[model samples]
Target: MKFSPLLAELINALTCLPGVGNKSAQRMAFHLLERNREGALSLSNVLHNAMEHITHCQRCRTFTEDEVCEICRHPEREASGLLCIVESPQDVLAIEQTLSYKGQYFVLMGHLSPIDGIGPDEIGLDKLESRLQEGRISEVILATNPTVEGEATAHYIAQLCANASVDASRIAHGVPVGGELEYIDGNTLTHAFSGRRKV
Candidate 1:
């Protein structure tokens, strides 16, 4: 039997999420329509609000509703002068969960992927260069993923730090090669963040 047009459209929309295939989308759509229209409505409202309100923080480039994120505005974090650079905003959250780092962050939003046409400018490197030129940061800890593109991005940023007379380091312990920082366990990530080696 064919699903009604609206139900089919809902299922198709649900499939847009990563890892949610047709069967999963159909299951979710049916579950929402069958058992929890109220929950679905609530989810829809919250998602709509977040999509409309959430934006990148001005200084760190992390997702926030404000012009500057709380972390960037914190006095202690600013005084610390330590900057941790990551490939994505999710990485910032992952490192925060480890509770081993208390410093400023620069979220690239993506790595340097030439094949995909993503470059330094596309990932907010110009803004990062402006921040580095400010001379407020003393060191930059490269917390980008262990992938090839991540490494390349890190090295490129390290050069920028060098140009700005800031120390640069790469996270060097516990994190496995080729693994994403977002997926690493908190303890391992903590160790990696704490054991960063000078680049």
Candidate 2:
């Protein structure tokens, strides 16, 4: 009739994950406890290790163990002078898989949401502005999601680039409105990146 306190706590903890509701969390808890304790233990270890060691890359704000991410550290990528900006690290991986872009990336980690109290500084826009002011970036490609918040964030960054006299462009709508870059098809993402236009 009722779950044990420890099982209920496990289910509640699982619900902290995005998109995971009570039913799904219960299912996951049961699945792990009954079918695969070994896998669950491994996942727990990995999650704890990552949370302790991973941090935002100083330059791009992507997750990394070092001061800078591998992309920013790569000497060959620095000379390209092109920076593609996206909302999260997942978008970075998505664009990289397309192989249509050769430049480095700047991850916002999130888009602007005034109602949620997320602002420019909250999303690290000031750091991005400083990077632009360095005058090394020849072009900035906005690859944020097509959602309203993403668009607003892009426009804000575009203005920041304009103030610094750097070129700013937005990826094409081949991504579809309300779509996230991480879910877009590789071919479509390639087309969007190639067809980017000035904002």
Leading candidate by lDDT: 2
Clash pairs, candidate 2, are: none
Give the clash count for model 1.
0
Clash statistics: count for each candidate: 0, 0
Model 2: per-residue Cα lDDT over 1-199, one tens digit each? 6799999999999999999999999999999999999999999999999999999999999999999999999887899999999999999999999888899999999999999999999999999999999999999999999788998999999999999999999977677779999998987788788887789
Report how far off residue 42 is in candidate 2 (Å).
0.8
Model 1, 42-143: lDDT tens per residue?
Answer: 999999999999999999889999999999999999999999999888898899998988899999899999999998899999999999999899999998
User: Over 4 Å off in model 1, which ranges?
Assistant: 174-199
Candidate 2 TM-score versus the reference: 0.81
